[model samples]
Target: MEKKRYYNDNIGPIKENEVLALKKALELCNEIGDITQITLLIHTKGNTGYLERIFETRNLKDFFRGVKIDQNYPPLKIETVRTFNDDWQGKKIVVAFGLRSNELHKYDDYENVAGIIAHQWSEDSVKDWAQSWGAIDLKTETEIEKTALPDKVVQQAFIDLTNSINMTTGITHPMDEEQCKTYIRALKKYDYELNSKEIFSFLTTELNWESDNANDVIKLIDKVNSGGYFKGGAKTGLQHHIKRWKSK
Candidate 1:
């Protein structure tokens, strides 16, 4: 008997404007005539609260056969790819979506996986990976509209991005001065204004830290600000570090 082969795609955190992307992916899976073999993967070190809300809002829970997300926080011990393969009952054809250069190599070691679907928004390196496997590129197959995220959603995205960085880098005490700067730099991308106090409240609530720990974190942030670390020129090399760590 031939083993069933699932198709995988890295959806990451589904934002409001990215709903079209999700719909297109599902449509592609349906076109394959085996929606049951389609698995949507999200990679994040932070909690899936926001994603859960999105799933609920869009009624997206029933559209896919499997939805896998990273469970461990900080230091990224168990990636979704390995966890998915561990639980997989058969072969898998990875359908990469906007995969970064460092993330292109994760599927190479998996024995059950033999193909890739280079979906839209995929990076050049990801496309190259699919090409090496003689896989199909769905780049021009789906036409997703470019929509701007709402101001409120943009602010939330900023917070989520900050929390993800904090969790991945293992910044427990005060959320690492450099990481905080990265968050600040990220704010420049959005029109929404977030003060330090607002950021502190959002992060503490998101992390669900103890009262004492939250106070300590705020104090450290204040100290870091006093030391002029928040006045950053460029985004820190934290993303570079994350890429290197993720590839490992």
Candidate 2:
């Protein structure tokens, strides 16, 4: 009897049972935060199985629908390089995503292919994704030196604000005073850990701000976790202000 085959758009042929198993495995990986990287193996008739790891960084949840590749082959990897300027500082974060075995030279449009597979194939899309990921969208140092924002005070304020929030918090920008107070109160009320998905969900459902995009809630939560205005808690003096706002 011929071996059963399953099909997916990107990965081609896979065993149906294998697909189910991979999906279950992916779920478990994500739950435990082991999903920082994922690899898919594809098996096709008349061709050796192909291994690929497509998603990178935050692109996992955004682009990865399911691991549709076959499991018969070992995981293969190709390098993808992303170079973009930071929002305010013009710094660059070089991100690498992988491609399948021998797929690099198969086409002349390697750059575009890598970009699409990484879910940030376009320049504009890359900028958007980077900013959403909290990469500071600032002018480069050279640009700032040449055409510095006229107001030195404002420039310094922005610099201070950006530096205050820790990078590990995954926040690229700072929230305003009122927004800061609201976030803190919610944090205290729900007793949710800073930057947790629970806080993200609460902000999405509870806040009635003008920006209601679910993604915005996540962004704000990122700022909160990065120490935003509430950095160092009461010692930073922001807690006093937040307390006053809560009273109002």
Candidate 3:
């Protein structure tokens, strides 16, 4: 099955005010060790105002050394390089976003950046998928660096969070042996194939528990136990399985 596209361009045209905010984003990136360099190439539609307009951006001019402003194209483009994998080791992963698009995009993947390379590229749509699923949107050199806690981390995080919910509320989401087995199999193929949003959908209607929050693994366990947040005197504390895995 084809993966769903993560974003749609419903927002209006881009504004210089918004681009100005890129300074703050750049600062944040530097703080997070997200980027070490900036290479600017401006292609502007034929406008005499373009030259002065480009130079007027005080914030962008200060940080970047390669500011090439052109009056021959559409909206401006921004790209970055950041570290991504063991193969490239310390290479940059390149993410690009254009003035026409409202969001940045990444194209880094193991299959794409699995060798001696300088950068990995990803599109805005793929970045959308990751962000929609709760992953950080860092369109740097490493494709997966902007992680929603890669599988191992997610698994361990899941365990900790679920465990905490159990202890605090004395409620546990019970999963039958078979359900757990099936879930593990799914995880092997798709740790993020299903996300909190998808899993939570099941909780609200199908489970008949009337919950707005759920997880594929934890929800299964919840159904098995039938011990719940409402019964435990907690409305949103329906996170037993996830919280439990977190404390350790």
Best candidate, TM-score-wise? 1
> Which residue pairs overlap in candidate 1's backbone?
none
By summed lDDT, the worst window of 10 consecutive residues in model 3 runs over 113-122
Please write out the lDDT profile of model 3 over residues 75-100, one tens digit for every residue: 22332233222243322222222322
Q: How displaced is residue 42 in candidate 3, in Å?
A: 10
Which ranges in model 3 have alpha carbons more than 4 Å from their true place?
A: 1-10, 39-95, 98-127, 133-248
Ranking by lDDT: 1, 3, 2
Score every model by TM-score: 0.31, 0.21, 0.26
Tell me which of candidates 1 and 2 scores higher on TM-score: 1
Worst 10 residues of 2 by lDDT: 141-150
TM-score, prediction 2: 0.21
Instruction: Give per-model CA RMSD.
Output: 16.8, 18.8, 15.8
Question: Quick one: best lDDT, which candidate?
Answer: 1
lDDT values of the candidates? 0.40, 0.29, 0.31
lDDT of 1 by residue, 168-248 (tens): 333453445445445444443333343444444444334443333334435544655555344543465444433333344
lDDT of 3 at 158: 36
Q: What would the C-alpha RMSD of candidate 2 be, to one decimal place? A: 18.8
